[model samples]
Target: MQIGITMFATDYAIPPQELAVEAEQRGYESLWFPEHSHIPTSRRSPWPGGPDLPKWYYDTYDPFLALSAAAVVTKTIRLGTGVCLVVQRDPIYCAKEVATLDRLSDGRFLFGIGGGWNAEEMEDHGTVFATRFKLMRERIEAMKEIWARSKPKYAGDLVKFDEMMQWPKPVQKPHPPIIVGGGFPHGARRAIAYSDGWMPIGGRGGDTLAMLPPFRQLLKEAGRPESEVPITIFGVGMDGDALKRARDAGVSRVVFGVPPEARDKVLPLLDKGAALMRDA
Candidate 1:
């Protein structure tokens, strides 16, 4: 199993490049960053994690920019968007960002994505909350065309475009791995339908271990090999037994969350995580 770290890059936190170098030196396999363009102050959409939404959601930097900074400074450690909100973005520009980042990182980009939960935030981007998942599927389909073909054209219910050329195709064979992030049957079905992998938060919906068998069964029912659609559990804290269970259960990767803080506050946590990685 692979071990990784994730943080919300913010104005006051440890700089992303510096954190990337630290993670790489400590032997972490990948680094992830989450994105939020702007939080709607209306507080209409309750945060899934808790009653009080953290400040990072409102203050986080763009994932592409933060990951790009990480990519240039690290040679081996992979860079990823923990979950880029594709539903709120234009596919053309988003595709270019993914491709450019992959090229810059020498094919080390992992595109973790999701249809986000903030209804008011999506409304600001002119996306209807109810149809966001459908829109996400179409946008990702359109982006895949942009990455793979010389002159890509897409005609879908929500997204339509004429044949047009985009530069800087991804360094990965067709494109970087698109890892769909969410929970249970719906997220797994989406992964089987289009994405390369599935990422479920460790304790959000249910215990990841409890969900693994059914997830694999769903993959089998869809005729997808278990190896093809790997499972990545995010926000797995430093639990040796849990790590062992995840590895034994055939989890492809486990990512631990790093609090958005200064170097002094973050490095010790990385040290503890690194030690856990060694043990796992």
Candidate 2:
């Protein structure tokens, strides 16, 4: 099993590049940053965690820019978006960003994506909350066509474009791994149908272990080889028993959350986590 780290990349946090270098030196497998294009202050949607949503959600840096900074500083550790809200952005622009980042990072980019929960936030982007999942699916499908075709064109209910030229294809063959992020059957089915992996958020009202077998079964039912889809656990804290259970249940990666703090404080914990994984 591979151990990785995820951070909010807040303005007050240790700079992303510094964290990336330290994580690489400590033998971490990857560095992931989460995204929120902009948080709405309406507070209409209840916080998934609690009544008080964390302040870091509103102060976080753009995932692409943060991960790009991390890319230039580290050679081996993969850079990723812990969860990019595909429901809020244009797929064509997103395709360009993903491909460019993969090129800049020498193919070490994982595109973890999701249909986000903030309804008011999606409304601001002109996407209906109820139709966001269908839109996200179409957007991702369009992006895949753009990445793989020389003059790609896609026409769907949610996405339509004429044959257009886009250059600098992703460094990773068939594009970077599109890891769908969410919990349970809906997200698992989406990942099995189209994405390269499934990233079930830990600590939510979801059983990462119990969900795995059903996810594998979904892949088989979808006419996809189960071995092709990797299972990643996100926001995993440093719990030995949980980690062991996750691995025993066939998790490929566990990304521990790193609190926004000074590098001196965070790096040691990262190193300790990496060492524990190595020794395991």
Best by lDDT: 1
RMSD of 2: 1.1
Worst ten-residue run, lDDT, model 1?
Answer: 235-244
Candidate 1, residues 24-104: lDDT per residue as tens digits? 999999999998899988999989998999999989999999999999999999999999999989999999999999999
Point out where model 1 deviates above 4 Å.
Answer: none
Clash pairs, model 2 backbone? none
Those runs of model 2 whose alpha carbons end farther than 4 Å from true positions after fitting are none
| Per-residue lDDT of 280 in model 1 | 79
lDDT by residue (tens digit), candidate 2, 52-152: 88989888999999999999888999999989998898999999999999999999999999999889889999999999999999999999999999999
- In candidate 2 the C-alpha lDDT for residue 69 amounts to 94
In model 1, the clashing pairs are none
